[model samples]
Target chain A: MSAVLETRGLGHDYGSRKALDDVSLTLAPGEIVALLGPNGGGKSTLFRILSTVMDASRGEATIAGHDVRRAPADVRQALGVTFQAPSLDRKLTVRENLIHQGHLYGLRGPDLAKRVQVMLEAFGLTDRAGDYVETLSGGLARRADVAKSVLHRPRLLLLDEPSTGLDPAARRDLLRLLQRTRDESGTTCFLATHLFEEAEVCDRVAILDRGRLVALGRPADLVREVGGEVVKLTSDDPEGLAVAIRERFAMEAVVADGEVRMEREDGAALLTPLLAAFPDRILSATVARPGLSDVFFRRAGRAFEEGSDA
Target chain B: MRDQTWLPAFSLWQREMVRFVRQRSRVTGSLLTPVLFWLLFGAGYGGSFRPAGAPESSSFEYFLPGTVVLIVLFTAIFANISIIEDRREGFLQGVLVAPVSRLAIVMGKVLGGATLAILQAVLFLAVAVATRSAFSGGGPGPAGALEAAAALVLLSMGITALGFVFAWRVDSVQAFHGVMNLLLMPMWALSGALFPAAGAAPPIRVLMAINPTTYGLAMLRHGLGRDATGGPAPALAAAVTVGFAVLAVTAAVLVASKRRKTA
Candidate 1:
């Protein structure tokens, strides 16, 4: 089967400011991918382009082989979109929102009704189906929003920050529901999220920074490429400690947010020499296996949180 | 699944109806404003006011059709203004991304607004008829009632579509308020709703002559068998009103077709 979602050198600009630039990636059928980036890192811009809400200034995006700009209706038909902002009509009940969404997708009568019922049940919103969306808690409302989008059994599900405003338990529920949706119907799920945990769970993670696709690979693979371990040390004079480590051991160190961070093949072995070299200056030190943030730091040359302009 | 036009339109229209019914303040506000304006303006101008060529009827009788038109105008304004709200609340974003056509979205919103406007206009007309103050000469029999109803539908659709055009372009309800104050209210006020074009100054008469709504209200006046000497002939007015409705809806569809430049 062809790729469920594909983009070729996709870029967008707001007047003179580049919001996204030359970003290219693809998702296989039934594979879950997360575009992980901090705020202002072009995630929402990419989301808007893929969801067919805005046209990209350069390159192209296609959903199920339909170009988003030239064949928007076809792309819209094959994709389910859940925006970062809550899209449910607050005045309408949970069930009503699903029914209306189904209609928009051309599902009607008893078939649409059955789908709404099934979605409500799957999302754990069956009992609250009759309640107005405004009356629902943030988690319940987010579930309803996702439920309505997927009610028509779309082939590709596009979610933008699906975990925003969701509590820990609610976030887990959402993830489980997404997994179940993919397991049952082979829906290709692509979500833009800032959370590393969310990115780690996806089959692949795409790291966007400064409007560029800096890194893209399976989460574990990307982390593995970051080398053995990440060693972080904090000191009153982080710059001084960083220079001392570089001069004494000829190791590169990044001073960010009052911490001197470095990746090492043998962090356990480096700790002894590193502490001996800066025993007086080092206040705290930690060595742990590399993770997504380490992968981002390796690719983008900055801490994950610092990648955002804000 | 095949892309649907009318199915989505009908669904959106149904949603509008549900929201309107649930918001009690909206229904009441659209009705009360027109009635209050009729009573105040009618009583205040009763002694000195007289429509040209119809001296027997009180100002209350002359203001009746205009008041009913006002109800339609208010309802249209209220209904279409929800577009800005929907945009702010992210409801419109969902619809815009759907497989539904731009025309369907416009039709759904415009027709939904027209339906609400017409219902209120008819209700106000019924009350006016019960008091025997609706038509100028007397009750406009079944044919006249049908004509009046036709004028109401056309007028409601026209104004609602016009409102949709402005509401879609504006980003904020406050900006839409600027549109309402600058465009919509003045459009209604100068449409020969307050006074006859025959009795107005040359420049004012020109404004009324060019105003498309003047023809709609004139058609309504003709249907009610009121004195319509200063306006165009009934057939011509109906044509212009129909043209106005079509033009407004076309503009709305065009605006809806343009996707958001920024998300």
Candidate 2:
């Protein structure tokens, strides 16, 4: 299958700081790929480069077979972008914003009106068509932004933290709309998000840290590869307990923020041994299946929480 | 997409018009300053200055045409603030990522700004005609009115294009206003709009010579039953205004297209 969007050794720098360092990835048609990263892990830089909003210092990008640098207009035609911040004109109504967007893509007349209506209804925004976007809640404004991005039915959709600031309900609605766009239109979807729950919804996920792609695969596969399950132990001296567990079990233990964590093939089987090994030191213990968070921590040597300093 | 360029242009233009209509306070505020200038300046000097060859009309007669140009100037220059806001809001990025040509984007925005300028000019003209009938004792004829409107439209096109080019590089609203004031105030003051440019310092004359608004005001005066000033041919004034409009618009398109390539 042909890739809808591809980057070859893409690198970008902001002054002395490298925002995206030698990054390369591809999204095949009809696939949903989540870009899991910390705040400054180059997710926004990559999105901006892919959307043709900023130039890369080195390397190449192509969207739907058009070179991003050499033929930006063609690339722009093939891609749609939804930014983290809402971009809708506050003075215009939701329907008017969509219509104006349709014009930008060269759609008009009865056909344009029909497409606007379809998008409005599809995104559950039909009833608020005439309402000014500025008056809409944060969630509704985000919906309008999404509606504008896809008005042209672009082959590739790049969403940069689309669910930020959205309530849980709005986030779910937005995700459903995104899935529908992919399933119904077969458009490749590239999403950048810090939320693990959001990443879990994608078909595949790539974890980026400090401008590097540390891991990439299906979320479940990454979790399994990192180890089967994660066991957490909290104690007065987690560092000492972690060392003791590693020496006794011949397994690696990670000490993070005063918590002892380790991956085990089986949580229940490993917990009994762990408890017996350090009965007096262990204050509390919990075992659960390895998740995306654990996978991220295992690969980056730090929890995702530390990376959201922005 | 290939055949209906005007559809997009018109839609963008209509969007701007609707915005101006919705923000009626902004419209009134923008118009108020220039109208005040007309009242204060026109009344203060109503009896002092007279066109050497003017047909024995009141000083307000000549002031009315200059006031019209001032209104257009204020409207076009201040409309650029919206461009800064649009950039901050990411709306410009949304438009840039679309399939339309970059030229279309610049043209659409310029057209929108020009439309707003024209609306403000109409409002100012209506007020001028209503409150200062002495200025239009003979009443501008249909042909003269058409000529004046044409000159105003061309002036607006040039000003709006210049504003767009400036807006492309300015990221903040404060920076935009600073640059606009620096550029617009000098152009407005030295363009013979507020006072005659003749016999001014050589530097001021030199400044007026390059100013597109100078030609705009000259053409407008000729179209509004005032003396031609025997300075430049009417054809020359029209040509200069059209030439500036073309250059400003072309520069705007080039900047936008370059931004698209590097973005």
Candidate 3:
């Protein structure tokens, strides 16, 4: 019922450059919220603050009723964080990595062993438990990393780009397991990822742009904001066609990457007039309902910047 | 809640042990590097070299403690390099976020490195005993063996923690290696491991006496019934070694887990 995680105007600055600026977020318990943003979009900064590894320069964050800045120990006890990098030692076996993680949380003896067994079984890693982490495939290693993070079964799980570098099968399995875990145990899952598809499965998606929260809502509702259909007209001279269409229909048409695109209540009503107006310049036109990227385009104008190094 | 440092520290140590056991190259490298140094440097410098005021032991026998110390340094440096790599790749962020004390993490890593360093040096001690008996005079007795093992552990702890301090400050692996050479090598060379301070020039003798490692070597030499270069009494030597360990560990924890500006 209460917010599992909440941040108020959280900001971070790297010397003169601001990495996060006046960003606020709230996540409810047992809900899967995805922070979808391009690289350098402050997703990591927010995650770091939530994990209590980095102190916010401005404002505050609380995790599971404890302030992350003033009460890191409490926050840590409530949170399980999985890194983007290879945290498991390449030289140690998968089981050993889990064992170490458990001990870090003060789980020991038979209890620790039992937890490891449960995690290995849950993640389908029993067969590969004895294998060195370096020897395991990338997907298996990532599975081990995830399993190790949740070994102590913290109240909140924070994953950074968990789907990156994972194959489609592994990615699908990870989402399934996470969703099942949340449904079964009522654990809160908040993940930061750039993949729009990954965010689609989450209950809520918070889209960040250049260190600021640009949009926040359900993926479906956000896309629905750009309701009806979008028309993309491919032409050799998209700017000229866009001007022509702007004059003819008095509707705003934007050209991006040499493609003239516009949205309307009914895209078919505008396609005939637009094509007839620029028959020589326009090559083709297609009408389709807006997707998540279309939602982002509506909000940010340009497409989501790719390959951010947040 | 009261701090539960032991569990996390022990876990880190366990991970280090498991890693060392799994990597064959690590096992071989830690074991063989000291032996190679002892054979090549000891033999080459044996026949023609003799320090004034030194005992009747052959040069190879005299080089034993130095080679063992070198192994400890090597193992510590080797183990702490992982810290630099981990920080660069963000592996350490996972560990830092755990509800564990920063000191516990440092202790875990240092203890792990120390255990491996001491273990490898103890294995090499057998060779030292045999070579000393056959070539020089005789091996250290049971008391000497106990003393050598304890000294190796303290030396390992100090060196490993020192490596942690340097590795924490350096961002790249290349810089870490460069720092290890600059920090560890000079200390080893001047610790009366290679040459005794008794017959050295006034400046060199003073440097050896002032070096904390000189006391470690002195303790090692005394434990094995060998005379030291008048560095210090074994009691004082042990105190200084422990002191170095404490200081290095404190510095390391402070630097690596400094109050990061983001939570």
Candidate 4:
């Protein structure tokens, strides 16, 4: 079957800086694709292009068989977008926002009111439908934004960091809502997030770094791709120990945040070697299965810290 | 194809109108500013000024129509401020990304602003009649009232279109305000709003003749029996206003549509 959304060699630039470069992606119907990248990796730029907000400097994009550039109205009609920022009108009630959004998509009169009511109920906003959006909690507001996006029941839904400011419970509620939306509406979802937990929820994820696609696969497959169990060793002289371990065992190790992490089939075997090789210099050692953070580190050669550009 | 076309356009227009109604402050604040201008300025200058042609009327009577024009002008100019705010808040992006025509978005905004201006105009007229018995005493004859209504509608349409153009081209609020102030204050001053443009200096009169607001005010003055400049050439003035309105709205639609394509 044809993809619900696709981009070919997409690129965008801001004067001298490259926001998105030679990026390509596709999403199939009923699939939830998570785009994970470090800050400034061009995820937002890609999102903007796909949503028809920014024009790609070079490349072609299509939504449900319609060219984004040539038939933007069709693309827009086929998709729903929830921006990262709060777009709800603070002065208007939640129901009013939904109603206005419905009208924009050609739903009106009894039909408009019915859609608003359905959205309010689906998002658990029925009780607060009449309250001004400014009075809603952050989570409620975010949910309202999502509700607004889906009021027209587009074929594809694009959400940019939907979990940005929600609490743990709210985040879980949002994820559940997303899952329900996919199950009920069969709407292909493209979610952009920096949160690994959110990425893990997707059917598949594409890891990006510095405007480049580093890896793309199921989350479990990505974790497994980083290879064997990881053993982390900290020493007073981490760099020296890393070099010593590599020289003695011919194993690759990376030193970061005062710890030297290495991949091996048997983490315990490496632990003895590491202690024996470093002896007095070794302070602590721990071994565990690789997680998403380790996968990102191994692939990007850097830690996943906030605000650090790839 | 035409059916699909008009459906989204009408939907967008309806949405914009609903937004205007839901946000009562936007409508009320617009009316309040002009009423304040009338109350403060009209009271202060009520004793000194005399109508250039009608020596017997109070300054308030002479100033009423101009004040009403000022109300429409201020509301129309500031209406664009909401567009700037919508851009910043990303609501504009939401609308732009939807399955609606760019022209529909521009028309919706212009129509929305015009609707607000109309409501404000009615409120202002009502208040003007209530505050001063003279305004109510010989209120425009039925024909005159109808003509005034038509002129107000056309004036609002032109001003609203211009405002949408400003909002579309200028992405930042500060930039929108600066450009609007530079363009609007002079037009407001020279459009015979405060005094007759006929007696102004040669340069000022020339500038007024070129200002679109001057045509709007002239049309309005004729509706009130104070000037004959708009009656004989009503079509000419309308053509000028419509020409500018079309140009502004077209520019706005092009920019918005292009932004969406690239974005």
Residue A93 of model 4 has an lDDT of 83
**CAPRI-style class, candidate 4:** acceptable
For model 4, residues A125-172, the per-residue Cα lDDT tens digits are 999999999899999999999999999898899998888888989988
How well is each residue in A149-179 modelled by candidate 1, as lDDT tens digits? Answer: 8887888999999899888899988888899
Model 1 stretches with alpha carbons more than 4 Å out: A272-280, B1-3, B132-137, B261-263
Model 2 chain A scores worst on lDDT over the 10 consecutive residues at: A301-310
DockQ of each candidate relative to the true complex: 0.73, 0.48, 0.64, 0.49
Better of 1 and 3 by TM-score: 1
Distance from true position, residue B19, model 2, in Å?
0.6
**Predicted candidate 3 versus true structure: per-residue lDDT over A1-310, tens digit per residue:** 8988888998889887788889888888789988888887788888887888778889888888899888988889888988787678777788888888887888888988998999999989999999888899888888888888888887899999988888989898888888887887778888899888898888999888778888899999999898989999998888888898899889989986568888889999877877777778889899998887787777766767534443
- lDDT-wise, the better of 1 and 4 is 1
Residue-pair clashes per candidate, as listed? 0, 2, 7, 5
> Between the candidate structures 1 and 3, which one is better when assessed by DockQ?
1
TM-score of each: 0.96, 0.91, 0.94, 0.91
What is candidate 4's TM-score for chain B alone?
A: 0.86
Better of 2 and 4 by DockQ: 4
Higher-lDDT candidate of 1 and 2: 1
Q: Model 2, A198: alpha-carbon shift in Å?
A: 0.6
